[model samples]
Target: MSTWRIRLSLFLNFFVFAILLNTVGIVIKRVIDDYGVSEAMAASLEAYKDLSIAVGSFFLASYIPRFGYRRSMLVALLAVTIASMGVAVITGFWITPVLYMTIGVSFALIKGAVYSTVGLITRDQGEHTSLMNLLEGIFQVGALAGPLFFSVVMGLHFSWNQTYWIVALLSALAYLLLLITPLDESEVQSHPEQAGLVEMLKLLRWPLVWVFVLCAWLYVMIEQSFGTWLPTFHERIFGLDKHIAAGMLSVYAGSIALSRFVMSYLSRRIPWLPTQLTMLGGAFVLIVSILLTTAGWQGTTVDSWVAVPPLAWVFSMMGFFIGAIYPTIISIVLNKLEKPRHAAMTGLIIIFSALGGTTGSFVVGFISRSFSTHDAFYFPLIPITLLALMLIPYKRLADRFHPASPGG
Candidate 1:
């Protein structure tokens, strides 16, 4: 089998989902302005999306290998394609939840399948780490495109629902690509009997797994706080037009994409832990400076990126420091495990990640509702600190598990 086609299919799979998943922030801003929903109500879109991911990953991840990775991804794409079309036609705030719910569940399948399939294609830890970062970088590219895509649609004076029509089309194309791409799943299927809920549950019993789970949870909490709410932050706090605010979010996504691409090269030459820690520190300082700079300033309407506050640009820069964190941690943990356990392990990672994203978005939204969006920005500081602390133990355990592997 040609690995390149399989890899292309995987990249396309992630690219499509990245756009769908990261559009939460853009959609939240839309519902608030167009549908007249409150911050908290709009925030529920994250819950509807992420909680479904958590639930779907918990129950379906372990069994994906048995179901076949290609088949799983195809089904996920089909589901989301249909859901996006429904949202495009239905055209109501109420239908928004259903679209997100479909995305969440479908992504659960896509992520698990994609992560597990990486283990099948790669030959060693270095290849695994490099490919994971590259895949995630492509994901960030799609994420960047998502906001920009919506910005164009809104700029043309189209309803946000119309954006779903394009999403549906992209998903349909991805579905066709995966359908034709052949994947060899024999290695994972060799022990199909071992792949089940019992084996997945057993992963929870490991101390190292729990530590890693904590790391995933915290990292995603920080990332989602920005990914799911940054547009709203700019629109509400910086007083940018809705389309411009969404367009500005592309800066954040683009930063992450660039950072991850850089990491794909640097992960081989550099130490992961130190690099990650330094990135976290940079993020912590940047967030504090942004919050302090933007404080007490009443929002003013701005029509162009040129007129946007300089400090507002700093908000998107947060992506530069934090982009590599997710793929690095995922590569580290999955690299430590055997191929047979990759799907199950990836499932655990997805479950915690979904939960963390939901918690972060909801907490920030609630805080924004109760206090202000500026005040809400402070919430990620807590997770950033906790994640930095958690990394120490996570790195130690990862080293203990694979003594021959590079500890960093």
Candidate 2:
């Protein structure tokens, strides 16, 4: 494939991924209610998912240079397709945790490889930022659309177990699309020094690398927290019916998708630091607003008899503003690393991200299960606030490693 072909293929692949990743968020409560599992066990679904991503990424990191990015992604696509089918095959309350865990692992392999491929197709910092922003926006498209698709499924009164099979079929289509598009993995730099294991390790240790890695990881946590628990929160905290609560969930995901898509355009017009700062600033303010709004809830109980919170629309709309984060952070981080090391760094970060997602979902699940989902709000704020503070150090780190933009 030509450069643009590779980039576009990878970009389209992200939409497929976003669909799979956010689908579970739509039916989380149904899974729990249907299967009789504890909150901790429910959380373990994410734990296993994270654990698999970490493991697969760690092992596959070295192979991008050896086999090829396209082949790696093809394998990942297959894993997701099979794993999704597996969930439907084994339907037990106790086994649901294990099934969800497999889903996490499959996504890890699929996404880890897909995310790292951006460095391969781009030639410079601006191209990196623009492409990542555009494609990551596509990812948000899938995330937003996944929930809406499930809403249609629920409307038809489809069972939760059947949904996985539906998602799996979509992934199978993506896998075939990838197979048809030939991929060429390029480490354009011929420097033998740049292509070794120790070199990759040194890059991973850099403060610039960690700031972005940590930022991306925790940001993912915030995303997953809202993605997994928000629908339940919407239903419980507000008095919306199931479909209506789900519509609110879609609104949040849709807003996030919209923001990320907008970032693609913004990246072309502005510098990375300023764009990121604005988004993070907005994120912190909105997060605080959400916290304050939830403070006067009186109790954790779902008073279905009462009206839903008026500010639900406000907070749901906030997701679009926060959507710029994941892609922007990746673009900033990859600017620091050379092409050859991008895959390994992607592998390493993905493990942590999976961990973050697992931690985010399960921790909130436990809190909700142990106390109330209401108590879970406090848990996400601390990390999200810390993520905002991280930008200061990130800006300095970017300056230290990369010179001021010539065109930027």
Candidate 3:
């Protein structure tokens, strides 16, 4: 298969993966509530998905080059298709956890394989950043639209559980795309004898890797907290109408996608540290402004929008500025590792990245539940602070890893 064809397939597959992931958080909530599972236990379903991804990535890290990216993604798509259909068929609350765990497993493969493949297809930072940025923006579109798509379906037909079938069909179509598209063999894994997990760990002995993982994990929690739950937060605390609350999330994610599109070009001019630090610091101001202006967004009604609240604007700004940081982190990861070790390192990076996704609900849930929901917004500040502090070090390290691309 042609390399461009493979790249297209990868982008489409990744977009499909994004929708499934973002939608599930909204989907399972109704099912779990109806099942009468406590909020915390029901929420743990997502954590299981992350845990599975982390474990799967860890174990499967070494062999992806052997199986190949297309095959790994294909297998992951099939798993998701089956899991989505299973949720539609099953009635017992007992099975929801299993299906979610299965999703975690599938997503682990697709994400680990897909993210690393970005490095494989492109030549250097500029081309890679542009492609990753464009693709990630579309993923955010899917994220923004997926929940609303389900919302419309549930609204029109009141068939909440039935929503899984549509996702199943989409997954099956993506599976077919994988089957038909050609794949490039991953350079990281072409060898007959690749580094084993133990050997992989020797490379990971660098403290920098763990630091990056923590940064990835924390940023996810922050973004997902507002992205996934911001609507609810607005609905409950600010007395914003439901429609407006939902739109609030749109503005946030839309901004994220937009920023990345620009960062695709912007990265060419400014260094990553300065760029990241500026965005992070800006986000810090927004977060504090958000918390201070609203009297606390705990129980705002969904139907009533009493003019756009000031904090709603903060969420929108956060989304746009936060966009490139993720792909930036991945770029840094790819640059840091030598070619032979890239596949294994990519897997662990993806695992923590996935963990960050899973951490979204737990962080929000526990923080909001233990303290006031309004206070929960402050939780993300801790990681944002850490990421900002690391900016100088990250830059110094990034220089050794990725010297500037030669001048035009």
Best by TM-score: 1
Q: Candidate 1's residue-wise lDDT over 258-355, tens digit each?
A: 88999999888878889999999999999998788777879789998789888788788889999898998898888777666788888898878877
- Candidate 2: list runs displaced more than 4 Å: 25-44, 82-106, 148-169, 188-201, 232-237, 241-243, 289-310, 358-385, 402-408
Model 3, TM vs. native: 0.84
Looking at candidate 2, what is the lDDT of residue 93? 60
Clashes by residue pair, model 1: none
Tens digits of lDDT, candidate 2, 1-408: 377666666766676677765665444566678876666666666555556556666665644555456776777677667766877677776555555555555555555466567776667777777777787777777777776676677788977667677778877877877777765554533433444345546666566777777888788888888877887877676556666676677678778878877777777778866666677677668767777777656534344424556667777776776677787878777767666666666776776777788778888899999888777866877777788789788878786774233211
Distance (Å) between predicted and true CA of 387, model 3?
0.9
lDDT of 1 at 231: 90
- If candidate 2 were superposed on the true structure by all CA atoms, what would the RMSD be? 5.0
By lDDT rank, best first, the candidates go 1, 3, 2
Ten contiguous residues minimizing lDDT sum, candidate 1: 399-408
Q: Give, for candidate 3, the lowest lDDT window spanning 10 residues.
A: 399-408
